[model samples]
Every structure is written in structure tokens, then in C-alpha cells.
Target: MAAPSPRPAGSYGMDASWVPWLWAAIGIVYLVLAGFSVFSWGAPLWVTFLVAVLGLAFLAGGALFWNASAHGKFLVWRELLDELPAPARVLDLGCGRGAVTIMTAEAFPRADVTGVDLWRSIDQSGNSPAAAEANATVNGVSGRTRFVTGDMTALPQFDGGSFDLVTASLAIHNIHSPLGRRSAIGEAWRVLSPGGRLVIVDISKVDEYIVHLRALGAALTVRRAGWRMWWSGPWMATRILIAAKPGASS
Candidate 1:
């Protein structure tokens, strides 16, 4: 695909709160301490060696953070885009700053996309409807895209059989109540016409979500997001689930 227009300023984003650079920060501090120890007069050989080793470990940890929390999130969008087809109705649940939302619009320009989010800064920096709109505008898909503020659990606001594709990215697990989370998934199911599909990327209780969706009588697949898709790598937790509502090409 051709390169997109300049990404909207302060619209595309990173959330420091989601995965803080504490490991990277600590690595820098350790390297500094190791250098200081080496240069200090009469520094013990073993102490310097130990500090160097510690620094290396933290550095590796930082790489994991960048891979899992940063790069891995984008893979979610790539996979979803692969699954979606053109000229379809799409919804993004908890589309913080339109990261996945705008990408979807850009990937399938013919498709109509809508992003809904609470836009709570505490949820993710740049998580706002205005940011999402600006992102879509600069990305050259604003004409076919829109953002709205709404709760995932109470998304009955959308009419039944209104959408062909629905996505939730790293957002649904925030629903603390089991009932609320199930309801939110149900809402996703409700908006889908036959043959519609739902894709979700989440951090916890993925199996629970699978069980919930299965109970709702849909065909679905659930699996670990794996190293490339897990920003935190295999340990920190991430999962992908895809479900189809059985019917047309949605």
C-alpha cells in the first residue's frame, strides 16, 4: 500500500501507563553505575563484573518491553486488517486514540468504520474522540470514518445486524465484572449480521472469553498471541480470539 499522509500530531500514540519504561530506565541507571564503578579508584573486579551483568539483564528486559508493549500492539491491527474486507460496516471497541481504528479505515478505505471509546486518559494517553477524528482525517479516511463516546458493555446503542466486522483491542479486560464483560461481548455479537466476524486482542482471562463466546453459540478460535504479537513476550500476557457469526462474506 502507498504511504499514508503525515500521521496526525498527538493523535497516533503510545501509553506510558500501559507498559512503563521502568525496565529500560533501570537498565540505563545500571549501565551508569557500572561505568562509575569501573572508573572509581580501587574498584573491586568482581563488583564491576557483577554490575555489568546486571546491566545487561535489564537491557534485555527493556528490549522485551519494546517488542511486546510497543511493536506487538501494531500487529493486532495488521491481523485484523487481514481479516476484514472492503465496503463493510466496522466498529472498534475502546479505540484509544484510533490506533487500531484509523488503521482499519486506512487499510480498507471503502469500508465504513466507527470507533467508540471512553477516551479516559487513565485508560490510555491520547484516548479521546477528538484524537481519533484527527487521526482519521490525516490518515485520509475521515470521510468514511467517525468516532463516538460509548460504553462497551452498553453498546446496544448500535442497532442489531448493523455491522459486518467488530474489533476490540486490549480493552475488554478492563471490564472488572464478569457480567459486564459478557454483556459487552454480547453487544458485539448483537451488532453483527450473519457471517459477521469479531476479533479481540486482550491481556487476561482469554480462555474465559472463549468460553463465553462459545456459550453464545458462535464458531470461534482462541490462542496465545505468541512472541511477535505479545509486546511483553510470552510472559506478560496477551491473547487473540476470532469468531464468525455464520452467513455472508463479512
Candidate 2:
């Protein structure tokens, strides 16, 4: 892996990255320009109304993004860790910034967690394996955590049923295509040993994810996560799916 930047544990560590701020900035700029035009050039009243609506929307979007990505994710992951068994081998899919992955390693000293991510720049600012490594090192779990540059749809390094626990935190929804999403779910199921547990958090299409898991003959439960999962209220439509491969104690 490439050397990580010399940042504290939190350097580039926010759950939602620059995108929300960018949207808010755009809205604020629009509002400012519209206000200037209205005062100096006597722009239309509807222009003011439009800018107000758009500006508020953008601000709300930014706030929601912050709540969902940072605080809410921490809460959800903490609770999930409590619910998970003491896994010997853990696989974290789409482990951005090493939040869940490092936390998993920290929580279970016996488990060696492998974090896999495509690390797309669009997903988060400074999202990379090196950033993840830095986060792990800062958290002092670097010994138990490993960052892998790879896709969720195909995990070639890990053999079938190798992981005792699998987790994906707000990561899979970025896969816009239906096929890729299914492949990710299938690959998680395939790589886990029988009775292994899989947990996922996504903004949308988790019902489909649960369906795919059920089709694989795994026992599963789906919940519309509470406010702890999404601080923007329930309208944001966040969901969590917990599934387990058969032949293990439930």
C-alpha cells in the first residue's frame, strides 16, 4: 500500500466529505448573486423567492449530509459492533476512511480486519487506501487492520467462507448499476464461511439487497434504521440489512 499522509486520526475523516459543503457553497453563491442583482439591478421578486428556496434546500442538504455521514454512522456502527459475534476474520467492504474497518479491529482484538475499497475520489475527499491506513495507525489498530485496493464485486485475495464477519458501511449505494450491486452482495455471501454474519448500511435499495441475500438461502432481517442511523429524519430513507449464512447458531 502507498504511504498514508501524515494526518491525525481525523484528517479527511468525516463521513460525508466535500460534496455536501460544495452544494451548500453553490447555493450560498446563488443567493448572494441573486440578492445583489435584486438590489442593484432591480431583479424580479420571483428571483428572490427562487434563491431563497434553493438556498434553504442546499443548506438543509448540507446539514443532513453531515448528520448522516458523521454522527449517525458512528452511532450505527457502535451498535452493530455490539451485536456482532467475536469474529476471527473480518472483511469490511467499501471501508472508506477506515472508520468501520478500524473500529472493528479495535473492538475485536482477536479479529484481523481487512478493509477493501475502490477508493473513488468522488465518494469522499482524500478517500484512499493510504488515508485508511493513516486512520488505522492513528487509532492504534494498524497491527490488526489491513487496507486492500479492490472492488467489492470481486474479492480474489480472500477464499470462499474465509471471513467470520462482513460489513459494508454506507458504501454500496454508490454502485449505481443493479448488476454491480448484486455482484457485491453475492460476493460477500460467497466469501463468508457458513454461519458468518453480514451487515450493511445503505441509503437506498436495501430491500433489494435483502432479497438477494434471501435468494442465497441466508436467514436475514431488514430494518428501517431509526434516527441514530440518519439524523436528517426518516425521509432520508436509510436502511440496514443483517443476514447470516445457514448452519450456525442464530
Candidate 2 structure lDDT: 0.81
Winner by lDDT: 2
TM-score of each predicted structure versus truth: 0.82, 0.83
| 12-41 per-residue lDDT for model 1 (tens digits) | 566545454676677788888888988975
* lDDT tens readout by residue for model 2, 124-181: 6678888888888888989999998898998888899899899998888888899999
lDDT for each candidate structure: 0.77, 0.81
Query: What are the runs in model 1 whose C-alpha is more than 4 Å off?
Result: 1-10, 16-18, 29-54, 67-70
The candidate maximizing TM-score is: 2
What is the alpha-carbon lDDT of model 1 when measured against the actual structure? 0.77
- Our model 1 lands, by Cα RMSD against the true structure, at 3.4
Error in Å for residue 104 of model 1: 1.5
TM-score of 1: 0.82
